[model samples]
Target: MAADRRVAEGLEHLKEAEKCMKTSFFKWKADYDGAASAYTKAGTCFKSAKSYDQARQAFLKAAECNVQNNVMFHAGKAYEQAGMMCKELNDLNRAAQLIEKAGHLYREHGVPDTAASTFDRVAKLLEPTNPQKAVDYYLIGSDITECEDRPRQAADFQKKAAKLLVRMGNYDRAVEVLKVEKKFQIEGENAPEVSRVTVELVLCHLARGDFVAADKAYKDAYGIPGFTESDHCRELAELLDAYDENDQDRLSSVAARPMFKFMDNDYAKLARGLQAPGGGEGGKKKKAALLDEGIEEGMEKGQLENQEVGGEDEDEFEGGLC
Candidate 1:
């Protein structure tokens, strides 16, 4: 009964807010500030009465009024509140959308930190049920932080996106995200992180059966200070060599190393799944092709040598005619 009474009171406030929006001879303005305030009160009352849908609608109205009043920060806050109400109603999709709108509003209001945080919240909310959407929000968060000159924060968000992609079995996209993360780490003078990301890039390439790309990723790390001496470089070298030699046993052994086990869960799983290229029929065919080419080249070289020897003998027999 008390909740119903609150609902009735909320409706009265809503009516008053609508009336405030009207213009008369005495008032040229639409009284947007008063409407926003009244709508905010209505939303709170509805929320307290456990009418989440009604609360969400009221908060969204409040946000619109705030926007019309040019109070962007308050508008963002109102949208955030609406998103919370959506969450309470188990409308996760709508919650994410509202929160994302709030984030954009915060960004447009010139509040970089708040905007980035809002984006991060939306990403987290979407991570469990909609990983792709989460990745999109994470990227948006990273871009915002990057533009604000927050390299470390940007790199952190990119790392999250990369790891999520790996878990989703999207290694190619993961590699691209990791590359961006590596660039950020390098620019930040974070050598250890750069080496770590390079190692991840190598593993991701390997996961996709791209041994050449994996080797190139390893070699590219040589430019990072101390990477050549780092354990990551050594691990990558051993892994690449095992793939090149088509040593399945050695590849498995290297992949089973403690370092690989200690990586993020997705990457750790990826490492465990790393197979030597020689293990497949395609690898066998490639190896056989290379061997045949090598034999053919060797036979051709031998024929050339014999011709040269015969010419020299013929010249000897000519008794220095020239």
Candidate 2:
């Protein structure tokens, strides 16, 4: 009871601070710094009062004030704080959005590393619910990392984006993103990165149900020096051979083989879905149907788990057809 009373008192103080912040904003023209200071005070009070939602809003208001004053660096920090509060509230989409705002501000302020890192976090947050958005954030991060002369980091982000693209059945886009991996390759040298990218491209093509393109990607990767040195690479070669020969039995055998354990789950799931009865026979609608069935199944499983754990249901966010 005492704790509740203390919280109520703190909330009253926060409300007073918020009123002062608003008065500073409207009554004093060009006093953005004063308003920002008031907003920060209000945010602190909101935090003390355990009003996280209000705290996030107050910090965002401060960020807006800083942005209006062209103090973008400070504004970016404020936005990051708001994003952290959103994370604490378990509002991942909102957090990702806030962080993305911070990332843009940081980039505009010439803070490449911070911008890249912020965008990476945004991508990670969006990955489970909105993979296309995740891919977009990852690509942005990759661009920033590449500009910072970090090819390996750039390739890593690009690869992650490609993986999501493949899962979303945007194989063409996946291939395009994976091509960025070649930027890390040295001329006239055997680079494992190059082979790795080619293998991913093969998977993308296969996921798109394009055996011809998959064959080309596979052969290209297989011809690379030291490609077969890796056991996994050899397995990929055998899989490609099966695909080339149009041998359904061999394809199924290889897909089921433990040697393919290194395959990404998204790739495996997509492959299984495509190979199912009447799968890959129709056009985009057919693909969407398959995806919907999988989504429904997943939702059912998630609901069951939630019931078992006595947790509130989480909202689902679906991305557009890739």
Best by lDDT: 1
Model 2: lDDT to the true structure: 0.74
122 Cα displacement, candidate 1 (Å): 1.0
Per model, state how many residue pairs clash: 0, 0
- In model 2, the worst 10-residue window by lDDT is 273-282
Model 2, span 275-313: residue lDDT tens: 412332334454578899999999999999878666432
Query: Which 10 successive residues of model 1 have the least lDDT summed?
Result: 277-286
Candidate 2 TM-score over all chains jointly: 0.70
TM-score of each: 0.80, 0.70
- Summarize candidate 1's per-residue lDDT along 1-322 as a digit string, tens digits: 9999999999999998999999989988899999999999999999999999999999999999999999999999999999999999989999999999999999987998999999899889988899999999999999999999989899999999998999899999999999999889887889889988988999999999998888888898899888887788888888888778777767778989988889888888899888876463444566789999999999999999999999999988786765
